[model samples]
Target: MADYDLVIRHGLIVDGTGAPARQGALAVSDGRIVAVGAIDGRGETELDAEGHAVAPGFIDVHTHDDAAVIRDPRVDFKIMQGVTTDVVGNCGAGVAPANDAFRAYYAAGMGPILGESDLPWSTTAEYFAAVEAARPACNVAAYVPHGVLRYNAMGGERRPPGDAELQRMREQLDEGMRAGAIGLSTGLVYAPGAFARTDELVALAKVAASYGGIYGSHIRDESARLLEAVGEAISIGEQAGCGVQISHHKAAGAQYFGMTKQSLPLIAEARARGVDVTIDVYPYVASSSSLAAMFRLGRGAAFETAPAIIASVKYNKERYEGKYVREIAAELDLPIGEAIRKVLQDEENTPSVIMFIMDEADVRRVIADDHAMIGSDGLPSEGKPHPRLYGTMAAVLEKYVREEPLLALEEAVRKMTSLPAGKHRIAGRGILREGWQADLVIFDPATVADVATYAEPRQYSRGIDYVIVNGEVAAEHGRQTGARAGKMLRRGVAT
Candidate 1:
């Protein structure tokens, strides 16, 4: 019998620690990396990884795949991109701990993003059980979404919660944290959660902090009030005594271009003051969200200057799906704002949109920041969802490391792997070290690229040769092998 379950040989090992690459071999046994940098033992299976960069599998720290894992177990869009772990329940959107009211609310408002209306679990623990039963293609970690708590406690009331309501929300959050959520996530721009004040968030965040969890937020505004939003997110973490993760940090709108110049420094200052704050950035300039919500916030003015594409629409598929807002307005022979209002009114505010809002310079600046990590923030809606869903990790390697060369291959791997794993407290899976879980990816550094485009958003990425999850080859040659070797990761719990 072979000494190990698997061995990968003759590859350049990028250990996910921002270390220099070195030619070596790695060995795995019983789902753990048993050896690295010169494996002499024989194995039951061997892969000749010549001309590839073998590193820890990418960890997607920002995703809304709360329902996708159960609805579609393959999750090829993620694993095919060498993402072995997905952190779900981002932007305060999720399907768990649902009552009938929240269920109905989710079916209507969050279906475009989460893609499922039928929520099978009523508690976070039950939800995790369902994830395990689904046997996903990649591991999953989750956050206790603030929106769910708010809706469960207050039924979309546009005011501060009374003392009783506040206690109810805190109780629900505490239940989720005890069930192993990594942190609390808030989408302050969305309803109910949007109604919540900074003090309200700080109260719930304290519950998560007591469990040693972090606080992640899609802040109140990303356009004109971007600075104030960042300050609020930082303040929540400061008061709650927890780390903060700013989701998809960006300055949206034409006037706010290059705003990260100020925002990034503000984050740095907070860190100097002993507040642990880090931010994640998707590489794309366009952002996806509910069309109605955008119009409600008066963000639709961006469509007047730049293009916005309909990502998913519950009705009027032929008229809207994948078409630009300007194009649709021309078809209707109406003004841009009028067209937006008509669409939301017609679709009942259910259509999702991809807005070209942020500047490329701002995106590049954020991606190049040392303290910043990578997140796709890709909304997995049905029609023409953002290409970042299928292509985020590969796109970073292709654009930042190979094309403009703004980052070295080693540094980029660090951002995707150890940096997020450490920050999110995802134990024992982000690095290829002895005794660590053997979740890894092997790709040709020169040819690794994102093939998925806005027009063809479902295409698999290029140059990801092998994706191993828990010592099993989950995907090979840009295709899923149908291996379900994933686990439901819990906070402070070693996998």
Candidate 2:
């Protein structure tokens, strides 16, 4: 007879290795998987997974929950969907290493996302300390924002840094890497970062690579110059010798609908050239961003464009929650872009909206790729918010796997688990094996689906029966059990 912490019996284990499922009883003790095969074991607690699929807990490799994790650390919106870990500080925006010197300029780039409160941390160490103080329900990994790193060296300057300034930027990145940040992230379409030249990015990427970190970018464009933007990312990887992850890999705009056909191959060619490259995409056809950015994307023209459907608007929250920009344009008897600008001017806070700009076929092509991984790009703290914040992982299982059979169950699990863990160099996570940490999710594959929609975005996903973080039960039977066993994971450090 063996005494263990917990054992999940009678489940089909997917294992997160892209292998075939098998019946197994997983035993956990002292925060690690002890045994994961047929066994007669007794534990202090036990769960009957019966007909559920047990796999390593999902990792949201791309997320904007950096500050949200501190404000509402329970992170129920993500945990209910089996997301055991969140990679935060994305889109060239982050909270750490920005003291009073860079706070205002950093706040301007973040817009309404940075409300009235002053940013709380001056360094990555302090940021990690705040996360520890919060006791967030899910584990967290931090990234060093390229723009914030630049801002540390040169405040709000759009021009390329001089030789001395460049060295200062590298120093900040090196500091963040040593402070436990896993990698570097950039938002090329946003200010300052958008001003960066290819050489500048490559130089900064080298600093991150020296510490075994990865590089992820919200590329310069997602529409007309989609392939060109992707090429730039590949170029950075080649010149810097770092693993690259393309964030929210999507082809937006009607004219460039199927451009993924070209973009993916360029990434493949880069891989052929020994430049390690991968991509992450959310499971939906719509994308979300600030109203000001939407207006800029529109170039102040027809809001009635085919794919510019609006999913959420915060100015007149009640009436505009579920309506599209085209509908608002018609209602006001004004041009689509004019309507967007007026709405922004009318609101005191910077408003946010969801755009239905992506093609379903494009999404299918990206998800089907062997090297691509899952990233919700979830913005739980943003206005009204897109359903992706709550439904991304669930929607993938329901729509892509069980419904249309676009991918096999084992392969889908791999994209959500081991693939991301491997790309980010997040050690010992993303797989279910002996000696690995006991981070796992058990859910009914048949019943797993997303209930959150554009109209009502804040809702828990269904079918996930049990969630374990650091070997402790964090959620059970579709609800959190008041456990905050999650820890802040740092790059190059063993868990």
Candidate 3:
């Protein structure tokens, strides 16, 4: 005869702990899970989930929605996917702690992701404040960008930090940690961060480690010398005494199709040697990134030789929105290299392209790893964006779990939820136990599928029924109920 605000009954519960599903009812009150199992309770709102699988809401461990959340607080693309939280500022690009002098550099690195928007927050604390004030639809945790730190410490300088400069960067990293950042992220191939050597990253990692923060890296190379990059990421974690997360873990280029075969062992060995390590991958064979990533992946020659490399946005939308680069070159009677140069040399443009760089076997190899988790690596503001934005979680459930039977539902849920929360140390979420935060999703596993494709990239996933965020039914029956119950989940700060 207990009272509750809401109750979901008769559902198969996948609790995000990699435990087997059990039939039960979950009760919620005051935005926290109050009861589970055979609930001898009643509530104002009751949901009959007889045929659905209920699990703790998904957590996107890697994302660039730092500015997208502020601009589009509804965040349908996320909440609809049952993602109750987003971990942003990955790939070492964030928009915070930027002074008037250094803000431009931060903006450049973040501009493609955030778009051309006025950045009012200059520190991690302010960024948190803005997100809270806007009342985002899902929870958000952040990592301070190493690229921004380097830019602030040395403006536009492609050189390793000297002693004084390194100390300065360390101070800023410490400030961000104190401001509630969960960790520090590095895009080792990007400028500023690219200029940083292992010793330099180790120095910055030490500052984050002192705060019990993790180090997430978009490693230097994922194509030719991927093992070396993986080795370096492991080296940073070992030397700095911080947990390491390899972001968007993938081996690009057909020549390097099975590189993860080598990379995974490095991680396993690192873990064996007491270096905490994990990786994330989206459930797609094709990867999308800036033209620069393609260039660095040694696909520059292919941009001219191949037509499948299509221009997605910014430079020429009229003639190249849905066509391949080679097609554009053919129509214009221009050489492939010259056609690519036209797009790349345009300073005003930040174009993103979708390249068929990964093999399905290679993608499956990475995602099937025990140490691997899920990250959409979705680019909201930039380019046409990847279908993973709307499709990643569903695709994993549909393609990997049910269709292929490559992964169990429990383990997949574990990756999207508890695994990430444990790695990032995000408390009070990722599990559906009593006293935990009430972020849950109800979906029809039988029909769960990703409808979004490369040709039409903005479609939402299928079979997601109800999404509850902090005990509020945010999205019910596949549509947003206009509830903004999300909070800024700080590391040590409790709401």
Candidate 4:
């Protein structure tokens, strides 16, 4: 018998550790790396990787592919970009602990993309069981969504949790952590979760911390109150004694266009103060969200209200379908609020908007910072979804490393792999070393580029020649190899 199942020969390896690249061969056996550098032994299979760069498969730290994975495990959007693993249940939205009532409540917002037959599990663990049974194309990790916890414990009420209700939520969070959730996630800008008091979050996050779980948040504001949101995240992390990650870190709106510069200092100070603070960013200027998100500020309503809001005459008159609030208001000769209301009246008619609120310089600065990791924040269900869903990893390699030259290739790879794996505590992943899981990628750095654009969002990327997940060929020659070798990563212990 051969010493290894496969050997990739003569490749320039990046190794995903932010270290300098070196030429070597890699050996894999029984789903883990057996050796690195020269291997004189023969193998059952050998792939000639001469002139290619072998690196750890990209791990997308933040994604909203809960439904997408079950529906189509191929996940061409991620695979084509060399991503072999993705952490789902982002923004406090996911398909877990799901009931018919909750499903109905979120249907309009999440869309009709999911089938009733698709969801056969409830808790996070059960959901992963379903994924395992289905055999997805890439590895997946999940977080306990605070929105679902609050809803399950408090019945979707828009008020501060009473002592009893708070305890129930804490117990539920504890249960999820025990069931293998890596952390707790909250969308403080979205309802029910948004209605939660800071103390409630602190208490629940404290429970998560006790179980070794992190607290990740979609902050209360992305624009005007960006600093306050960051402060709130810091406060929660400090009080809860847990690590905190700001999901899709960005300062939105023209008003806060250059505010990332101001916010970075606050994050730095918090880190200096010994609070574990980190951030994730998708490489894009435009953000993707439901049509209702554009008009539902301060409104504690379920996603079901979206379609009705879009059908209103005020929305049509304002022409808020595909344009930003400022742009629509300008065209309609109306106040921003009026334009927003009109846009909400015809929710289904109103497509998701691409709000160009972030500054390119701010994006570059965040990605280059050692404290930040890359997250797609990509919602795949939308009609005109943000291209980041398909282009984020490629964009980082092409734009930041090659074109704009903001970060070195090795550093960028680290942000996508090791940094995120370390943050999420995914063991034996994100590194190209012996005894590590054989999740790797091989590509041509000179040719790798994102082909997807805002106008043509679903196009696949170029230059990712091979992707290996769990020692199986997942993508080969830039095409899916119909392999389903992914596994659900559980946080083994609650923290």
Per residue, candidate 4 scores C-alpha lDDT tens digits across 1-495 of 887899999999899999999999999999999999998998898998888889999999999888778877888888889899889877877777666666655565454322223356666677878878878889888888888778767767989988898887787777778877789899997767889888989998998899888999999887778999999999999999999999999987655778888888999999999998999999987776655655576321212122212212222434443344566656778766666665555555234555565778788878877899999987665344678889999999988888879888899999989999888877788989999999999988888899887656888788889999999999889778988898888884211
TM-score of each: 0.99, 0.95, 0.96, 0.90
Q: Residue 274 lDDT in model 3? A: 95
Off by over 4 Å in 2: 106-111, 114-117, 298-302, 307-316, 319-322
RMSD of each: 0.8, 1.9, 1.8, 4.6
- The candidates, ranked best first by TM-score, are 1, 3, 2, 4
Q: After superposition, how far is residue 213 of candidate 2 from its true place, in Å?
A: 0.8
Expressed as tens digits, the lDDT of each residue in 1-495 for candidate 3 is 549999999999999999998999999999999988999868889999999999999999988888888888999999888899999989887777677756665455457645555678777788889989999999999999998888878876877888888888898889889988988999987766788888999988999999999999999988888999999999999999999999988887777888888899889999998999999999987776776556655687656443354536665676676567778677878887677666666634466777777778878988999889999988885445678888899999999999998999999899999999888888988889999999999999899899988778788889999999999999988789989999999875545
Comparison by TM-score, 2 against 3, better one: 3
User: Which pairs clash (backbone N, Cα, C closer than 3 Å) in model 3?
Assistant: 97-122
lDDT of 1 by residue, 1-495 (tens): 899999999999999999899999999999999999988789899999999999999999999999998888899989999999999988887987888899999888888667965887788899999999999999999999999988988889999999999998888889889989999999999887899989999999999999999999999999889999999999999999999999999999999998999999999999999999999999999998889888888886788997899988888989989999999999999999999888988888899899999999999999999888999998878888999999999999999999988999999999999999998889997888999999999999999999988888999989999999999999988778979999999996878
List candidate 4 segments past 4 Å from native: 112-118, 298-343, 348-351, 492-495
TM-score of 2: 0.95
Q: Which candidate has the top score in TM-score? A: 1
Evaluated against the true structure, the overall lDDT of model 2 is 0.84
Predicted candidate 1: what Cα RMSD to the true structure? Answer: 0.8
Query: Candidates' lDDT values, in order?
Result: 0.92, 0.84, 0.85, 0.79
- Clash totals in order: 0, 1, 1, 21
